[model samples]
Target: MASSSKCAFLVFLCVIVLLAPSEVHAKSMAKAQGGWYLVEGLCSKFPDCNKHCKEQGFLGGQCLKLGVNMLCFCIHT
Candidate 1:
């Protein structure tokens, strides 16, 4: 019974971890008044995306892995 409880707890924790990122992403998207911008160049790091977006007069940006591509999405208010 204890082992089963531990397994259930692990499953619940895994689900939370997986869903947390999406929830945060959705909230960020909602705050993007100027919408998302597809930044050109390789997004090897998150800070690189942020720097590019700031140069373009945006609030900030994030590096997202989309299938075969690592795309940069800039957000602005």
Candidate 2:
């Protein structure tokens, strides 16, 4: 019984570890010169980012993929 419990615990741990990272991730632009930061968000197309970017008051926005997910990048001055 103790061995079975251990196995179950290990399986649970494995699932958590394996699926910990998501396919899509949102991130800010790195080292954007002139105070430009890359904004990241989940998206499926270019327009999807426009609203989000406008809300943030960014100069513009664009959609990009970091892994398996589409992210919207809002560019601000």
Candidate 3:
């Protein structure tokens, strides 16, 4: 019974190892599909970021709070 449990654990570990690379690759692929750019200034509000991105000819923009800094990311197709 103990040997069977150990075998099951090993199988589970192997499955995780096999799936890890594909997951990482998928994330990278998604990032490559629609590019993201860091805007020049801090994002005080999402609407302002969106407007800025539109003016810059991007599809849209989002304001992300990283620590104390509010950063804007412009998205394009």
Candidate 4:
């Protein structure tokens, strides 16, 4: 009766707790692919840059420029 209902409720709560970690991991993956979400969400309140720093042509000089731009943009406004 009442005791069984309480047990069932406890089991439901335990199931929800078990599922919570998966939900958190999924959200983290989503954020990683979507953008620099956590940093922007916490700090200067925007995603840092759209440019990719690891591209091939960027090694010569372009990445340096992009990096500078990103730093300036992130720091100033």
Give the alpha-carbon lDDT of every model: 0.65, 0.68, 0.63, 0.32
Sort every candidate by lDDT, greatest first.
Answer: 2, 1, 3, 4
Which candidate, 2 or 3, has the higher TM-score?
2
Best by lDDT: 2
- Any runs in candidate 4 off by more than 4 Å, and if so which? 25-77
Q: Write the per-residue lDDT of candidate 3 for residues 1-77, one digit (tens) a residue.
A: 99999999999999998766433311111243558554434565445887888887878777766455666667766
> Best-fitting candidate, measured by TM-score?
2
> Can you write out model 4's per-residue Cα lDDT over 1-77, one digit (the tens) per residue?
99999999999999998766433312111123324321112112223232322222221111112221322111111
Task: Give the poorly placed runs of model 2, Cα more than 4 Å off.
Answer: 1-18, 23-29, 32-35, 44-47
Model 2 C-alpha lDDT per residue in residues 1-77, reported as the tens digit of each score: 99999999999999887665453354646556566657565675445687777777787777767565566777777
Q: Estimate the overall C-alpha local distance difference test score of candidate 2.
A: 0.68
lDDT of 3 at 56: 78
Candidate 3: list runs displaced more than 4 Å. 1-34, 45-47
Give the clashing pairs for model 1: none
Q: Which ten residues in a row have the lowest lDDT in candidate 2?
A: 19-28
Of the two candidates 1 and 3, the one with more favorable TM-score, higher being better, is: 3
Query: How good is model 3 by TM-score?
Result: 0.45
Off by over 4 Å in 1: 1-41, 44-47
